[model samples]
Target chain A: MTSDAVSAGGDPRRLLADTRTFARRVRVAQRVTWLPLLVLGVVTFGAILVQAVSRPVTTGCRTTDAGEICKVWNPVLESYWLVAMVAAYVVIAGGYLRVARARGLGSRVRPYVIAGVAAAVLMFTLIAAGAGRWIVPDPHDLLNPSTSILVLFRLLTASGGIGLALLVLAWLERNVALLLFALGYLAVVLVPINFGWGSHWSGKSEGAAQLIVNGLVLLLAGAGFALAQRLRASR
Target chain B: MTGPVDTPAPESHPVTGLDDVVHQRVRLGILTIAHEARRVEFGFLRTELGLTGGNLSQHLAVLETAGLVGIEKGYEGKRGRTWISLTTAGDAALAAEIARLKQLIARVETTVPRQGEAS
Candidate 1:
């Protein structure tokens, strides 16, 4: 382990210089893992766009005492979107844990596990609550054929995003850029839903909105990555 | 003419109070990396530090013996892997080293005259 720097009685200057070198190395190491995940996100997002544009819409009907309720269902879009989301979550979680581990911060995994479990429990609890009619009278609103999956997707996004953000913030308390990335990604996922722009093939404006949101998300992510690299390089 | 004038030897420079175990380049690298990560894989440490398998294991053993790092061996998809992480004591030690380094830098800045000032 002895080197010219180390053998120099651990001089503060040497230590600082060495630290910077090590940090740069760590950042380079992390980029190897992060790049692939970024690629995966882009590919998944592209697939969702493709499915949204081409999939045929089917109508789903349900009989009730008052009348029959009907709604358009884009199964292709829904299924593909759900798969993409799940894949994203898996990739994000796995990549995060791997990178954290590589950097020697394995203790941070606890929060991730806790967040995941909490999210799953929340999802089931919502489902059960809706089933029991304890909340909304219409279970369909909470877990209907059209909205249930979307709700689940949103819940997963919130849980995963918030959890990862909290963990990263706790680890790198000074890195506000990470927090921005997390919040930005969360907003990118939730904004359209909040505005009632369902993730289905509707029209040109919908597609345009999706593209804009995705672009913003990628920008935020890229910024966060760049900031991390810069921070590591500087110190 | 005088043959030579006395000058301070480079070897006479002041020493830092950094821990001997933590001072080694490879060990310092390990600690720094571990401090950033929650738990690091043995393979990652080896790759990042550019150490051979045997060499990294030796250093990890030394850190583990010093109680500065913890090592866990487990199986990952039929392959055995080792995970290394800093203990609480290790974290404190690394923080102290960094603090000392910062102080040393500051002290040097205040006491040492630059070329322009010396002129």
Candidate 2:
């Protein structure tokens, strides 16, 4: 309270302790991770609807020394993803800026937004260049029991680059929880999961099931973080 | 071999290294928060330090005059807000102050006698 509280004869230990506590409080108060998590979750979940509505247009199939490479291009899906990803980044940036303005605190989310937008553009470019067809193969072969696991890694682009860009956000926020979630999410993106492999769940769309699961994971993490933030605020 | 080169001895005490502008408790808190946040609003600083508007304004003016902090006035939506950011000099001064504080604490611990000590 006093102007010269930390004068020469004063206790440096107390001042240092109080400063540390203040810094911790500021760090906690500025966190707004749940907004992006929830928004991305919804965007990812909506991918299933887009998948069902947009039919794949096959250009042609050719036989090569390596294998059969079919060019099945879906302009609808590509456009949807490009627009969705760019919009999501805009929404996230706006959300952070709004929160910062309201709370009178600054957020370090620009790097995350930039990385996300760049990743989305890159994914769209790669797909347009015929990378998706080469990696995914024929739709009929996708659900076959003998389908290669490598084929399923295509699901990593389910959220249109939002999945990998989360790592950038984790670094920006310096959030360990978010970093852990991002790593786990990356594993989910890379690993092909057949939810209805053996049970009554069979005959269902395997890709759709995987997307639903990914969306649920994001939603659940968002809810958990929101609750934790609430508890911290209440305390 | 040539004569040994002379090396200047360190300061008599770490207190000599302490910066007057940055040593006060409130000012140090302001600089610390600004350094961490990169840009902090004036209202947030006032609320966090539990200081009155006048007191916070006085401290900010001192910091601004010393060229240790930069002040920008802008509108956040319809409301006018003042933002404070630490300068390069401010950051360096804070680091130096912390180092001096650490040295001062270390000296006190080593030289000061504990309870029931012979000295």
Candidate 3:
């Protein structure tokens, strides 16, 4: 029978057209949602690399049971690195909010963005404060502080970092794998510090740890970009 | 020319198997967009579908009344915005509509003869 004889059936062409339109719309939306986070990840990796290279190292003093002791390098640069990393995070959060607004993601996302920014700021301030104490010591004691405050700040910093990471991850749903990689990176960094494992590292071991962590970060960033490219190409 | 060519009856055809509300072009577009996102903005839908504010609102109202979509109004910064999302019922309806469309396509493929065969 001629196809025209089946006129009572809906047009197959029309259904196909609708399906194509839906698919196209979804593809466009996914691209818009993910592109920003991907760019931010690359930029963050670059900033970290620059900070690592430019970081200044100098001999410093520590207070031990015997007397005032000298250490090979003061971690002053680490503070600066933390500041730069936090700044990058703030920028990413701000950019995400702008993109969401532009795409009409509604006002509901505003609170999450605000919370993310606040967490970034809190993390930065705590790290900077700890670094300041190291660089400019109090007259009575150069190395030690109230142990309670030290532990409190460390906990706060970890919480803030996790909070910001989660907010960014939620906004960048398309790059979920990358975001999880980032969270894993954070966990690797924070878990050791939380347990005070760094205190046991000798000077040489400290350097080795730093190198290993930095290498892992580079690997994660590189893998993230590659996966993002594969996803885009497939799309 | 051949006395209406004996068009297939409605009961015998698969077109009647489709849902009227979900099959509409604009409504279908709305459902498709909402399904992709956690929650979609009213402005986004209007821009994507190329519908006026009032036109989109009417369609949204119909969907809302039918328990297919939920509309939320809230403020972002200082400005008011409306968010649109598909209800559970809406998601199910959309899925069913898509399945029905696929079945129809398959039926057409099996029943319609190729051009070379006709010759």
Candidate 4:
């Protein structure tokens, strides 16, 4: 029994470092960050197909002092996202449960799922209440003075909501990596970069192209984290 | 380096402060993992420490007997699983062990010179 004792008589720093490393391994083993990221990434990426097939209808036009602001509605895209996001949330929760059971670990994935589904519901509600008209940028009104407000409104979109909900997930996980990814994803969602170059290559719309970029970020982050965990575990 | 004048008493050494039950290599590893995870599974502990089920169980039994760890034997689904968590006493013991280890490190580092350094 005495022989099994750690020889703290030796360099304790190495011992401390080894202990910390083992703790990190345990943490990485239990994390399901990659699961949610991959799932959400696929959903966001798939939205491009829905966007491509659905035609935007100019429902109505309102005359304001600034100019004519027309309401653009894409019922198909909206409906598809509503179902997709809900399903994604369910799948993520189930995935966590499965992994936990298989690995004999406990999972705190419920709050994240709840938060994600809530965001999806909130987006659907806003759209149902006619707030969706205000979200889309009207082609006719080019230099709208409320551009900042419009950007803020992006938080209500599916991608933006996913980003926002991830902050909740990050908090629950207490993982700095997830928190950083969530912040980065939120920035991309709010002020989407025009990846029109990718659109031309893929023959997809600019909207779809942007979604693809967001989706790629999710997928890459997911894969990167999973790979890192595996490497750590192997070590 | 100055010549040593008098040796300290053995009981005054930082290593003396280490709890025998918590200071063992496997038991220390278990406590550290449990402290970090808050709640850890028995399988994870066994795998992480590279210990057999019986070996890990013996260590866990020692920890439980010392009131350092709380172990639960329950079923996750149809399969029964064991979960290990640090009790308040366990948490305090771990903290104390680390603190002692740090003190031990500091003492050794200050008294000992690097290989390349002038003695």
Candidate 5:
């Protein structure tokens, strides 16, 4: 609130010069926050979520065989979510990219966005270890024995990498945000009972996965708000 | 008389140089706006400073000639955009001007200490 910039110990002359650069960065930082990163990311997430919830029920066999009815759309539903997850990654990655680009972060932003994507990739790597299960009727392999401790540990490490990168990004930007939630998700999943819930969330319709994924998405939205407000108020 | 001098001194005391630059409202406003926003479009500066087309043009010309500003043009989409940024010389001058103002305030504050006591 003290606009003239002088503070506890610095000479009046020193304060003005210090404020000069700070004010300049703050001005453009607004431009960066208002960029389209957050909204687009959230929308993509919503779309993926809607598909997860509704697709299984809506897409079914057109032909009527009564007791012998065969569904053509089941395979599409099984694969549709995979494509949705990839799109979700793209949108989420874009949100972080926008924050970096608008801030003129130069080399500072790349590593963080990379880390988040790496975490996503590591999740897929765990999924690959359970690819044997996904091959037939059951895609809910989150806690299946085939998932393996080694795969889970690698996925956890990847999440740790993401959390570290996001922390660094937030520190540089001077905001603490949904970073804790991201870290928390990895921790919650390590418990055997909670671990099954993740797969259950991803598979079971109108269930806990909706709650968790939507809640995580909301947390991301909160982080974006915190980031934008912090930018607007910086100088 | 002082010895013959071909050019003025490169740096001047506050009283010597500030008067010429400070009184031009448009240039000062431009400096303040650009001080807040490190750079702005030429049109934005004109609109924000509220100078007439010709008036803003003349003032900007003077600042540009004085090495206090630089202008460049580019296109955003099909529309042309002109960018204005304070040159290093301009930034230094503005910093010096702010310092000069603070110094003047410091001088006045000592004399007017009792006057501001109520607030």
Candidate 6:
């Protein structure tokens, strides 16, 4: 055979290497990348479950004031709500992953990461600005389902996005920009909602946890974008 | 005289450029389905995997993040639809993956041990 033909004779090790690399990427996305969220989801859900069983679900059954109502929800209703919350989380999380995957580990996530960071930073600033509190250290207003519902709706929109973004970080863990973007997305939703659900610092912690989540999201998004860009450029 | 120093040029990339190929079983499944059709739907993959929408979605996210598929959301009839397609890179990767796999199989088959002797 000519030297050209000999040069064209392929190497087997290259195929093995490619397979290993591809497998690693898939493995990262599927397993290693998802740990924190899985833990957070399980713990949060468990806490809520315990609370539902333990807490009265209503505060002022005997009081003569605007507190005469009992926490009237049965276990079944609570179960349904649990399922719903999970479903919503799953759906939102799915969106983040999708965006990440589409974007890959590179440029596409830049815009999203920027958007998320902007949102998170904006949220933190807003909270630091102290315009409002949705969930506070106080629960005198907790029974006010009307206001709670309003806050819940907002949480559904903003936090949902943050959660989705957090899930995206599997693909491009190398990008700190992605991590910032994830944090930003988290802050945008959580800073306000933390005022609704928990304490200021806890809200801050929510923001912090969001950083991790957002990191995941950015990685996933980066990977996705990288993959897509690579694919497109090839054609 | 030159005003300022410039960054050094980056090293050249690797040759036999299949590093970016999609080769996993599920990713291959994703590419195969996407390649065969104009667009593959989310629900379709769910049924194929016998997995809930959530699990399939996660996998799809992986495929998407890797740039092997393009997903377009729209409607078929009144309901929302998620349509996925292979990008050009994805197509190339798929083709490369196929050739690579074929090469691996050929290598193994030819190098098969004779009567249990390690070849």
By DockQ, the best candidate is 2
Identify the runs in model 4 with alpha carbons over 4 angstroms from their true place: A1-15, A49-63, A68-83, A108-111, A121-151, A165-184, A195-206, A220-235, B1-24, B74-80, B88-119
Ranking by TM-score: 2, 4, 1, 3, 5, 6
- Model 2 spans with C-alpha error above 4 angstroms: A1-17, A59-61, A132-160, A197-206, B1-14, B74-80, B99-119
Two-way TM-score contest, 1 vs 4, winner = 4
Give a tens-digit lDDT track for model 2, residues A1-235. Answer: 5454323344687667666766766666667889878888888777778877777777767775556656666678778878887898899899987787677777777888998888888888776676755555565443342434453445336453776788888877678999999988877777656665434443323367777877888899999999999898788
| Cα DockQ of the candidate 1 complex | 0.26
TM-score of the first chain alone, every candidate: 0.48, 0.80, 0.43, 0.80, 0.43, 0.27
Model 1 lDDT at residue A216:
47
Off by over 4 Å in 6: A1-235, B1-21, B116-119
- Per-model CA lDDT versus the true structure: 0.59, 0.77, 0.59, 0.79, 0.49, 0.48
Lowest summed lDDT window (length 10), candidate 6 chain B: B12-21
Q: Per-residue lDDT tens digits of candidate 1, residues A25-65?
A: 55454442233225434644564566556654535456765
Q: After superposition, how far is residue A146 of candidate 1 from its true place, in Å?
A: 32
Which regions in candidate 3 have their CA more than 4 angstroms from the true location?
A1-10, A30-98, A106-235, B1-13
Q: In candidate 6, what are the lDDT values of residues A15-121, reduced to their tens digit? A: 44444544344323322223334433443344344444442233324443545433332333234334444453444345545643442311123333544444444
DockQ (Cα-based) for each candidate = 0.26, 0.39, 0.14, 0.25, 0.05, 0.03
Q: List model 3 lDDT by residue over A83-131, tens digit each.
A: 5555655565566556655676522334444555566566656554445
Which 10 consecutive residues of model 5 chain A have the lowest summed lDDT? Answer: A1-10
Worst 10 residues of 6 chain A by lDDT: A1-10
Question: Ten-residue segment with the worst summed lDDT in candidate 2 chain B?
Answer: B10-19
Backbone atom clashes (below 3 Å) for every candidate: 10, 0, 0, 0, 1, 45
Which prediction has more favorable lDDT, 4 or 6?
4
Model 2 Cα lDDT, one tens digit per residue, B1-23: 89988999865898877788888
Which candidate gets the maximum lDDT versus the true structure? 4
Q: Answer with 4 or 5, whichever has the higher DockQ.
A: 4
